[model samples]
Structure formats: structure tokens, C-alpha cells
Target: MNAVLRTLVVLVSLVVAAPVLAAPAADVDLVKQRVAKVGVLRGEFSQEKQVAGFKNPLRSQGRFVLAQDHGVVWTTLKPFPSEVVVTRDRILSRQRDGSSRVELDGRQQPAMRSVNAIMFALMSGDAQALAAQFTVKVEAKANNGWSMQLSPRSAMLGKVFTGLKLQGDRYVREVEITEANQDVTRIHFSGMSETPAALSAEEGGKFE
Candidate 1:
């Protein structure tokens, strides 16, 4: 994966790890109830990556669409234009003019299955699926807000990420990822909406 694609994957992976709140089943249920159940969600994001030795964090802004049972379309609009579409079958990166930059087939890359499973679970708020892979701790915040801390359960995942933190009210508002090398990435989501309730024709076509 290229730098942009790798960053996107890390973002998605951190999201997938968010639901593993280690609180009681009732607490988890409360979080589930608080999250909006929508077929389609659209939002804007600002991301910052702080490398171990860098004095300044790399920043980028973007928009994203998450379609239930379909996939995610992430379009980075600043620091250069690019798009990454991730579906169950493949991960495709496209250039500014819409030419394919790279593609990874799920059949050829077994890891794609895991990535897809996590991505879908994150989009759907599937706590059980996420809890299976991470050690989670959840805390209920005021005004219907909640926060979670996650640590990888297996050594393999641990090699990639040391820990993750997520906070949100009705939807995920922020995610922080700490990689094994001590680099950190923080993502904030804004302008979230469930309006339209379904993907538009253009958005739907990206999944294909």
C-alpha cells in the first residue's frame, strides 16, 4: 500500500477497533442503542499524524461515505486530491483524474478479508465482532456520549497497533491510533448526517 492508502487503512482499522468497549454487556448495549442506525452516513474528516520524531504532525482533510453492507468511499480533498474505495472484494486507489492507482484483490490478499470484516463491523456497530479481536474498556460520558480504549488481542495486531481510543455521542466523532512505533494518528469527524438514507447513483457506483 502507498502512504495515503496505508493511512486510510490505519484509519479504518482504528474505527473497527472502536466497538470493543470492555464494559459490561449492558453498557455495550447502551452504546449500541445510542448510535444511529442508518443505511448511509456522510461526513467530513480532519486527520493528523504525529510521527515519533517529527515536530509537526501531517494534516489532511476529507469527506467520506459509509454505505451499510456495501463499503466506504473516502475522498481526500486537501493536501492533494485522491480517493480510496474499499469493498468486500477489493481495495482500489484512484488518482485525481479517476485512473486506478492501485488495486488489491481479496482473493489474492487474505488480509483483505480481515480488513473488510472489521470495516463492515465498524460501519454497522457490531460490538461482538470487534470484541473478538481487542481488549476493550468503555466509559460512559455525560449527555449520551461514550468513550472506549482498545488494545489488540493478538500479537500480530499488536505489532501494528499498540492501542486505540474512540469517543462519540450518537456517532463516532473522534479516533486516536497509537502504532507500535509510537507514532500517533488522530481523526475527527464532523458534518455527519444520515440524510438521503441511501447512497446516490454516483456514490453507489463506486462500490462496483
Candidate 2:
């Protein structure tokens, strides 16, 4: 994938932990109560992107780590080995040979700073933060399962993302992102865990 597409994938992967809720205040509280709060969450993910005019969707599978205090580590192991790490200050990507590149520097790009804040809020299940950006519609299901649809509220965000749909019970299981150009990306998360409650030494090194 090109750098811009790769960056979009990284952003989608980081928000997999977001809580799905309705626009109503009570529903927001209800959804928050249902989602599991943890300092660290790790999982495996499979993503498929359906680009306009492409007959087949592009697919990739990988693993991800979300640390509330640190940031996210997304490792793409198929098709090619690569990794993307997002922290408060910047977004970094690594090649299989250990070469690292700064994808975005929040200090220099004010827009990236906002993106970083949104990412952190999503992963941390900050419903209020989400509500400020997207108009959310939620459906409650049996067994505490629920689903939500989100549309960007700002003109800037709307220029890129058309909408998003997310679903889960205790954790977000699926996410579908629709772009303005009609390209759609679907992501499924599995093997999620909160155990270990901390990053491994090697994983921690990626942030530095």
C-alpha cells in the first residue's frame, strides 16, 4: 500500500477499542458501563479494504497492542512485515529490517495533534470525546451486545470519512470505515486480552 493508505489503516486499527454509544447522555453512560476498562488491550485483527473500481478487496492480517498510558503498536505480519507505532507526540512506522520512519510529527503538524487526541480518546473509551466529533446512533442488543453508526460532524473530517459502523459486547469486535470517495474498509478483531496489564520490553522499545 502507499504511505497515505497505510496511514489510514494504522488510524483505523488504533480506534478498534472505541466504545460504541448513542447520542443520548444516558445511552452513553450505559455503553460505557458495558465496555471493559483496562490499561492495556491486545488482539489480532484482519482487515479488508474495498477500493472503488477494484474487483477484489485488499486484505491483511496482524496484531495490535493498545496501552492507555502509552499508545498503540500495530504489527502487520502478512503480505509484508511492517509495524506502526502511535504515541502522543508522533506516528512511527518500521520496516522488517528495523529501519524506522516518522509518519507524522504532532509537534509540527497541528492537525496530527488533533488526530492523536482523537485516537487516544477512542482507545480509552472516552464517549464524550467521540460525541464531540461524530453524530452517533446506537442499537442495544440482547446479552449486552450493541452496535453504533457514526458520521463525522465536522466538515474537515467529513471530507475524508463518510461514516463508521462499530459493534461489540465487552469490547469492540468489528469496525467499518467508509471514505468520501466510496472506498470502504472493514476490520475484524479477535483474540483480545487485557492480561499482562503491561507492555513487553520489546514492545515498549517501539515507542522510543
Candidate 3:
């Protein structure tokens, strides 16, 4: 996928987790149901997005790995080699050729804290808890999982997603991130596998 589009997807789908996919797989329904059961996934995805204040959309592609308790990694391997690692405590980001940034809740960066909260909600896939946290509405849901539409319950979430759409299952298929300015970026996911795959802890954190 295009780098800009992938970036947009990461910014949107993973506003709270890794980026995810490469190819379509069989038993698509079975895969989604599995995600609902396992709750952790390893996959790759190609995405495209458009944000506010930008004339054109941004595109990108990346890999995603998630662990129910350990954490999640979203890595963009093109245009730039960058990664975000989210865990129980913090959301940390590093770029292969850039600075590594770390922010903890109620400690330093307020923006990072808010982003952490949102990502936590996303990773957990707890609709009731997330709904309580944000002004979220379930646009759709069933055995296949759900699509949660979220708005800022407080000024905090608003700053990150502005207007957020999370397409859920075990792995996400789409995420739409909008800015307060009404600029919209849509990330559609395909070619994802929800197979019960695991990554070593150290392997999970490494961007390369």
C-alpha cells in the first residue's frame, strides 16, 4: 500500500493499537469469530486516509501484532521506519532514524495520555467501558463484531480522533479518523488473518 495511506490508516485504526495485512484469507467469517474469541492477533494491512487541512489523502501500509496482555505494535516500514508500542502503562513511539518518544498518563504529554486512553478502549474491545469513556455509539454490531462510532466525551479524546470510527472484530478492518476541521481519512483493511498467532515478547517490541 502507499506509505501516506498506510500512515493515515495507522493514525486512524491504531489511534490506540499496531498497524495490520498482506493477503485475503479463507473462512472470513470463521476468522472474525476467532478474533472475538482469541482477542489477540498478528496480521498486516494496507490502508488509505485523508485528514483535515490536507488537500489530498495520505496512504500507507504496515504490520500489526497484538497480545491480550503484553501489548501491541504498529509499524510503518516504508516512507519511514516508525513504530508505536502500547502497553498497560504507556504508549511509546520510535522511528528507525528519528527520536523515540514516551508519554505516560498524567505525567508529561496530555495528548499522549488521551491517545493512550482511546487505544486502551480499542484494544480491549469493551464496548460498554469505551462507551462510558467516550461519547460513543454502536453504529453496528453482531456475531461478526462491531463498528463503533466515537466522539469526544471530553476535550481529551476530541484532540486525537476528533471523529473516530472503529471497525472491530479480533482485528480491525477499517478505521476512519476525522479532524475537528472535518477533514476525513478512511482506512479500509483487507488481506488480514485472525489466526491464533503469537510473537515473542522481545520480538513483539522490535520494529525491525
Q: Which candidate achieves the best lDDT against the true structure?
A: 1
What is the C-alpha RMSD, rounded to one decimal, of candidate 3?
9.1
Residue-level lDDT tens digits of model 2 in 1-208: 4333365545544344344334445357656777788988999989899999999998888998998788888788887778877887777777767765547676765455556666665554555567766887778879998777778875656767899887888888888889889999888889999989888998788777
Candidate 1 runs further than 4 Å off = 1-4, 7-27, 122-125
lDDT of each: 0.76, 0.73, 0.55
Better by TM-score, candidate 2 or 1: 1
Q: Candidate 1 residues 148-167, lDDT tens each? A: 77778766677788998878
Candidate 3 residue runs with Cα over 4 Å from true position: 1-35, 97-114, 141-145, 159-161, 168-170, 194-197, 201-208
Single out the weakest 10-residue window by summed lDDT for candidate 1.
17-26
Q: Taking the tens digit of each residue's C-alpha lDDT, what string does model 3 give over 1-208?
A: 3333233333443334321122122223333343454546676756565655677766767787766656667777755677776665555566756565533432443334444445655644545445544555654456666676766554534554577777866556677767766767676555565564666656554523
Which candidate wins on TM-score? 1
Candidate 2 has its poorest 10 consecutive residues by lDDT at 13-22
In candidate 2, the residue pairs with backbone N, CA or C atoms under 3 Å apart (3 or more residues apart, or in different chains) clash, namely none
